[model samples]
Target chain A: MIQVKDLKRTYVVGKVEVHALRGVSFEVEKGEFLAIMGPSGSGKSTLLHQLGLLDTPTSGEIRIAGVDVIGLSDHEKTIFRLNQLGYVFQEYAILPELTALENVYLPAMMRGERRVYYLKSGIDILETVGLGERLHHLPRELSGGEQQRVAVARALVNKPKILFADEPCANLDTESSRQILELFKKLNKDLEQTIVMVTHEEWHKEYMDRVIYLKDGLIEKM
Target chain B: MFEKFRVSLFLAYKYLTGGNKGITIFTIFILTLVFLQLVLVSAILGGATNRFNELMIDYQTGNVVIEPEEDTEYISDAHRLMSKINALPEVTGVSARIKGVGKIIYEDRSVGATVIGIDPLDENTVTKVNSAIVDGDFISKLDRGEIVLGREISGGYGALMESKSLGGVKVGDRVNLRIGSVDREFRVKGIYTTLFFLVDSSAYINKKDMEDILGVQDEAHEIAIKLNPGEDEEEFRKKLMGIGINEEIRVWREFAGIVELLTRTITQIGNILNLIGLLIAFVIIFIVIYINTINKRRQIGVQKAIGIGSNVIVASFVLQAIFYASFGMFLGFFAMQYLITPYTVTHPIQLPIGPVILSLSNTEALFRAALLFFATILASFIPAYKVAREDLLKLIWD
Candidate 1:
């Protein structure tokens, strides 16, 4: 579960205040499949980053699983990110040197898991993303769609409480986008994996149980 | 935690062996030079000191020579004075001698040579005079009438042939042994070389012949004594200072002033060599480790962003420096042992330097090397800490 109240994030660009998130509020319960939609400069990704503990909100309170991440120390924040949150960036943020299997098990290894446990779990996560046989393949070797799939497997390998995917389908072809949407829908239903995804397409709303639209840093429920 | 260190070491090994091998190899090169520089300095200092001592062997070692109590050109009771000095526990040997200034005459020429009269058997133990003969022989067949020579004096007098005696006088030809205002004919028997300049052609006769020439039936000119090495020559000199004879005390090391200067000069040269070596090591290690840390900027950023501490990264760099310095040390060591040392055996070369600083023997050497290593590691910090403290999320975006 996650909760954000009246979040406001500002940036100073040459003595000018840029409000990326202004007075935004949101909540997602356990096992909820939420899709966040917004145009450019809409603060949708910024909000997701705050929720994933990747960045802290400048003036707001964020609680994940009833613990206030804002009051936590730097080390505590790192532990929370490692154990509870996972990220899948739009650009396929995978280390180029590591193969898909190594990338998937990175979070688990960061959590201090036994190598044997991570080895088997990495295989299972790849299989869940339909990349069972491409474990050793490098990201550069995989297509745009397959690389995104590896990112998804990496996010889920740690069995995080919530998976945050910002623009997961932004770079894919239409058919590849649909395949990714269907894959998320199936994962949400079968594994009860809570996902907070960001997308720009309107018809892709069917992939999630609820949709939250953001305009100019303000949330508009539809 | 142990796994992390193990992984770091594995990566380090690969880095040293693989694409990043230059830094590691350079470290070995630096250490080797330092080790060899130290060993070379030691060998030079040791050899130089020994050479200086050997030169002193043929020259002077008179400590408390006793002459006549009254003003006299020669001591009349030389045998009795020698017995008195030789009886002391501190005295090891004694020589009775007549210091007669004379002209050595050759065919149509004359040269100044000190005519020193000695009891041949007694003088040998005090001076080890026989050992210095490089040509001809010692004053054997003394009763047959012979004279020894010095290498330099033999050249100066135009002396020729091994068997020819003083002034090319034949075996039976007589030469003058002039003392003060008298001359005696001495048959030429054999020629020999010695450490002193005049010994080459100067005649040696039985000591009684010298007493007959000086016209002193009871004594000789001076009695030279050989004291033990540990006996302080100066202290002995001072002990005999006010005894008020025409005699004086002399140390062998004093007469060989040039040798002492040479020993000091060699030590100074050794010091200079060590400083030069240390400077070279510093410059080489600094550039190499700096480049290595710079190249790893991205990797360092990743580690720090992943919650790794700054201390851990610094520890890794320190480990790298130690690996490099040790490699260089042994390399330099082996170079000295197997290469430079053996070559010096045949041809001794002196390195112009001061006394070696021996930094390795003290912590200053490590302090210097470590300071250079830390400087190299710290040189990386500008880039490492810059990336380390940056926003992790932003880095992921990049």
Candidate 2:
């Protein structure tokens, strides 16, 4: 479960202050698949970043699993991110030097898991994402859709409590985008995995348990 | 800490061997060449100094020497002092010499040379003068009236001699010697060379002949003493002073003032060379790692975002530097031990002081290797820190 109370974020470009999030507040219960929909610069990605502990909020309170995470130190935040949350970026940000298996197991490795345990878990997750045959291929050798599947497998390998995806299908074709969305639906239903996704597509609303729309920096509709 | 180090080491090894094989091999080659240069520069300087010291000890000064007292032309009661010195437990051999300046004339050519009168048998014990003979035999008695001409005095064509010829004086040729108001004729028994300019320009004769010519019988101008192996010359000098001998005593190091200065000069040059080597290594590693980390800036940010600490990323780069430096130094050690040292020892480089052979002690080699390793660490640290501290969001997005 996640909770946010009046979270705000701002950035200074040259001398002007741009408020990316203006006291926006929201919550998602455990096992819920949520999507945040908005136009460009609606603070959708900004809100996700703040909730995911990727960046600090200008002013706000954020609690995950009933614990205040806003006050955690940098080191504590890194540990929390490693043990409790995972991220899937739009660009398929797998390390080029690592094989698909290496990329998937990296987060588990960072969590101080043993190599054999993480390797087995990573292979199982890759198989679930239908990438069992490409475990040894590098990111560059994989097709765009396959690379995205590897990224998804990597995000799920650590068995985190929540997965944060920022425009995961933004760079995929129509068919790949539909496949990825179906994969997310299956993960949510079969594994009871909780996920928060940001997207601009209107058709993805059918798969989400709930959809929140934003205009400018505040919640406009739900 | 061990876990972190293991992960770092794994990442470093993977990155090093994974991509751009040409660049990796080129960088390693450059490091190997630099390490070899550092070893050779220091070895050559040390070799030159050691060669000079060996020559001075072998051909000129023994471990210790006693000269005439200040303001005295010759030592008084020289035979009594010699006997006392020879009685010491540390003394190995003692040679008393009568030194005088003389003009030598042979076959219408003449040159001024230092004439030394030495007891042949005793002189052999103090210094390897007999082994230096290049022509004819050494004088067998103190009254042979035979003179051994130094290679420089006889031919005047050697590393340390002037170009003026001595009329091509050869063995079995008779030469005239004039010291003060005494003139004598003696046959040139042999030509000997010590490879030292000063020693090779002097002539040696029977001690009895020198006494008769100079009218200073039963006195010696110098007494050279050779000590047993491992005996400390300065300690023995103090002990000899305890015997109440009234003469100026000096060690071989003190007698060879020029060689001492040369040793210090070479050591200072070696220090400068080491500094230059360090600077070169630092710059090379800095640039190599800087470019490497810069290329991986985005990957570094992604790693940080995925809960990897900055320390782990920095450790990976440092480990890469350590690998390159350690491997290069290891190869350099083998090259010095198996290739350079043996070749130089067998065919020494001819120098003005003497023949120079490479010298590399184990401690010296290890110290240089460690110095280079630390320098590489520092070099890699600077760039790694810069890359590690960058804002992750900008790196990931930009």
In model 1, the runs with Cα more than 4 Å from the true position are: A137-142, A174-183, B1-382
Chain A TM-scores, per candidate, are: 0.97, 0.98
- Give candidate 2's whole-model lDDT: 0.86
Pairs with steric clashes in candidate 2: none
Top of the candidates by TM-score: 2
Q: Against the hidden reference, what TM-scores do the models get?
A: 0.59, 0.84
Mind giving the per-residue lDDT tens digits that candidate 2 earns over B1-398? 77677778878987887867787777677777778777777788778767767667777778888998899989878788888999999988998999879899887889899998999888888988789888887787745679988888888436355455484677899999999889899999998887876678888999999999988877998899999999998899999898887699998888778776777787788778888888998998899889989888888877877788788889999898888888778878888889988999899988775688988878778888888998999999999988888777776777
Model 2 chain B — which ten-residue stretch has the worst lDDT?
A: B156-165
lDDT for model 1, please.
Answer: 0.66
Give the residue spans of candidate 2 off by over 4 A: B62-95, B100-115, B121-126, B129-193, B198-203, B213-257
Worst 10-residue lDDT window for candidate 1 chain B reads B351-360
Give one digit per residue, the lDDT tens place, for model 1 in A81-130. Answer: 76787777787767565688977886676566788998899999899888
